[model samples]
Target: MARMTDPTNALRLFQHAFECGQIPVERGRIDPTLMFACDEPKGRTRFNYMRAEGRTLSALVMFVHSDMIEGHPCFNIGYAVAETFRGKGLAKSTLVAGLNEFTNGLNGACIPVIHIEAVIAPENFVSQQVATVIFDSTPVTITDRESGLPALHYMRRINLPMRRL
Candidate 1:
């Protein structure tokens, strides 16, 4: 999977994903406002914040350092796999790679902890199963106050001890 480091490239990927309908426009999946949230700025700030990675735009993820339920700066991952790429393990692999990259702390200093959350529709059993395996557990159902959509929140955390080398 290729990790996108350049802002221009990231925006291009986002636009491509949107045009391909990998993300639902009605759900505000790729809405400009949501894409440029305060939690994640626009342009390079957002692009730099999310370690974007994928293969040929078929699958990709946008990850960020955010305060998870544990109140720590853990990686929060959001992804979209093109319809053709589904059931091919690309999503799972991409997510795993992204997690590993951040866990290893490519920049410097191990993050010490990592967390991923997936918000899925209750009827999206396929995605639920995928998340179950990646997260190693069933997701908890939650009411999304903002959209009022019934969503399943899947989460996982990793913590390890090691000397800074």
Candidate 2:
């Protein structure tokens, strides 16, 4: 089941990013189904995914929070694909799909529009390119809250309140 297996991938991502926290392996597992809910029951929820074809690749997920950045919504994306999946347009397509879903470009009952604001680490060039080209985002220097480190903040605005059809 997703509950039993997702943590393995989550742990891989968490450890690989060096996010500076000790992953508690003994802790109760989180249910992956909760991610697709219309709304999160708790704060800081993110949608997670793996490629449908036997999941040889994982889609690093992005989350948009209603509460952030001076009381307005903002997106903080963090994702990683297996090394083998890199340079194959996977990340670009993933980002495009995500942006379209959030920006009323896709059909749905209610599309919640939230601007994506990615903070790329200084050395992460590929992601920077994705932000710049796909989202047409421009970056500015800022300090990352997680590590108090210098980073690039890429912002792409979107329609607000989403569109209800």
Going through the candidates in order, what is the number of backbone clashes in each? 0, 1
Q: What tens-digit string does per-residue lDDT give for candidate 1 at 1-165?
A: 322222235445665655665643221122211222212444322211122233234555556654555554554456656655567876666555555544544334455555666677687676666576568877788874436677777778777455566
TM-score per prediction, in order, is 0.60, 0.62
Q: Which candidate should be chosen as best, given lDDT against the real structure?
A: 1
lDDT score, candidate 2, position 157: 57
Candidate lDDT (C-alpha), each: 0.52, 0.51
Where in model 1 is the C-alpha error above 4 Å? 1-55, 106-110
Predictions: Cα RMSD each: 10.9, 9.7
Give candidate 2 misplaced runs (Cα > 4 Å): 1-42, 69-72, 104-113, 160-165
